[model samples]
Target: MYNLKNKTMKNFMTIALLLVMVNTYAQQVDSIKTTKVETVTDTVNGEITSKKIKTITLKEQAVKTDPADKGKLNADRIFPPTKVKKTVMVDYDADPFYDEKTTLKYFELNNDNYVFRKSNDGFIMNVLNKDEEVLKANARQTKSGPYYVVNSNEFDGIGFFNKEKKFVLEFYNQKTDKLETIEFAEK
Candidate 1:
């Protein structure tokens, strides 16, 4: 009789523990919602107007382990948010021009002006107002397409004439590790 009572007590304890664990897991939330409010004020001709904007966002809570994706590493749970890529914009002090005596062509990119002219053995790029030479490189004509291979110490650029007769220059910037493009519209 004592042995039977002990067995029953063991079964009861095991069942109670399983019920408690199942109840806790069932109460877990799958997603969360957040609300945000923004206020804007506008003034026009001495008149003022005020407005409020309300926004609601829903986000999924990260699951530590997914049953459907068993045995696979969860990259989302292990890795943090991705970092934003940093880009450097070209800056020019002056507007460049194409002079019949020296420059082969003139180009503008991102509102910055530049002149491409022939050097002794390569091409030289200069900013109209700046005293320093921006880039110097030799070009190779590729038979594959209308692209010209241009190289410099800091950048490697590929130039091609587009369908609209516009010259498009793509540069691989070494410092920022980004691709920069400039367009030269034919006049």
Candidate 2:
């Protein structure tokens, strides 16, 4: 009788431990179902300024198990749908006179207005009159894209096309000792 009682108690203890383990595992799965992730990006002047990722756990839901339908899992019924919000920011400032198609490297700037063209020989500075005629003073590429710099007694800047095909220009400001950027986007 003593041996039989000991065996019964051992069985009860083993069953209790297994029940605790199963409950713990169920809680872990429930936690995973309620987890949410969010992503955010900020862009300035066609460049990524910052990115952020965050994860959060939502309220727990009551899950039901059917002994008759064992091993058949319905994911939609087990976990409800969650909505995530994403945010992005873009900033652009473009120069009005730069043209990407012309084969010359020189650009004309007159009273805050200018025209840019590519040339094979050297730098070309032209002053445009009221009739839109070119008055050549100093300078003058291929149809293919190449990085180019425009520097003259009055204007100093660099122009290039980015991978996204956006025309970007950086102008040096001698008075403030800073570089001002201008970008032209196709879209």
Name the runs in model 2 displaced over 4 angstroms.
1-113, 121-127, 132-145, 162-167, 183-187
Clash totals in order: 0, 11
Residues 32-70, model 2: lDDT tens digits: 323233334677799875333333323333454545667
Q: Which ten residues in a row have the lowest lDDT in candidate 2?
A: 82-91
Candidate 1 C-alpha lDDT tens digits along 69-115: 67776532332212121111221212242112333455555555556
TM-score of candidate 1 versus the correct structure, residues matched by position = 0.33
Worst window of 10 by summed lDDT in candidate 1: 80-89
What TM-score does model 2 achieve against the real structure? Answer: 0.28
Report residue 68 deviation for candidate 1 (angstroms): 59
